[model samples]
Target chain A: EDQVTQSPEALRLQEGESSSLNCSYTVSGLRGLFWYRQDPGKGPEFLFTLYSAGEEKEKERLKATLTKKESFLHITAPKPEDSATYLCAVQAVSRGYNKLIFGAGTRLAVHP
Target chain B: GAGVSQSPSNKVTEKGKDVELRCDPISGHTALYWYRQSLGQGLEFLIYFQGNSAPDKSGLPSDRFSAERTGGSVSTLTIQRTQQEDSAVYLCASSFGMQETQYFGPGTRLLVL
Candidate 1:
């Protein structure tokens, strides 16, 4: 079975603190890995998509890197505004359509 | 351009009552998806529609859940005989293609009492 697991269920960091969230996945064939940020009572906002191992992408203060069995979301100098639940999902090549298997997510809090 | 949109930001209902949620995909998006998110949980895939193909409903939790995409633009999710466990945020997403990045709507919060 394909599964995704995110580590560190919750984290608290002071403003400007840098950290990384981990997502490990098991799939028949890796197709893509996605990162999303979700605010309270809001849907997830797309962050980045990594297709192959060793691939990385960035936006603003966030960077995402993918490997054979895991992916990491790096937050640099995070601000309170960046506090949100980070979600990681994986798309398997064996799936007929674009179905994504998602992890439980990691809740992050940045304090000033 | 406007992103995906869902109707009725919040809904309160009694158990056994039926509820319907709506979603409008992006202007030219050919793929639309529906998911359920519980408090402190990740997204649970519910259904998906791509162009004129048959919707993928494998993720629906029960037979009472059904969805339809009309004209490949707007989609509706209907839950029959809602249960307290059915309460959650229903999210809608749309993309240019099946493999493309999906943009999500604000989501509809459902509470069954």
Candidate 2:
């Protein structure tokens, strides 16, 4: 069975604080790992796609790193605007079609 | 220039009634997907349509849930004999190809009374 688990279900950080969220998964064959940010009442917005271990991607104050069994989303000097639910998902190579298995997500609050 | 779009930002219906939600993918995107999100829950895959190929409905929770894509551009999700537990946000997304990055719409908030 393919499953994704995100730790630290909720996090409260002050502005300018740095933190990291974790996403662990068990899949038959790793194809792609995705990160998304979803605000209230809106669909998730794409953030990054990590395809292999040791790969990393960054955007402004956000950086995502991948490993064989997990991924990490590191936030640097996060702003209040960065507060949202961060979702992690995985696509398995064995699935053939583009089906994504998603984690429960981590809610982040960056207060000023 | 436009992204994926879904109709009826919010819908309220009584239990046992049926409802249809619509989605319009990007101009040339060939892969369209439907998902359900309950309060504080992650996105649950419902169905996927790619070009002229058959849709994959394996993720659909029940037989009462059905979807269709016409002309490979627009899609609709219909829920029959709705129940209160069916209330959730129905989200639509599209990608250029099977493994490409997906773009999502604002989503339709369905409320069953």
State interface RMSD in Å for all models. 1.2, 1.0
Task: Specify the highest-lDDT model's number.
Answer: 2
After superposition, the stretches of candidate 1 with alpha carbons farther than 4 Å from their true spots are none
Q: Show pairs that collide, candidate 2.
A: none
Best by DockQ: 2
What would the per-residue lDDT of candidate 2 be over residues B1-113, giving only the tens digit for each residue? 99889999999999999999999999999999999999878899988899855458888999889899889899989999999999999999999999998889999999999
For all candidates, state DockQ relative to the true structure: 0.73, 0.78
Which runs in model 2 stand beyond 4 Å of their true positions? none
Q: Candidate 2 A-chain TM?
A: 0.98
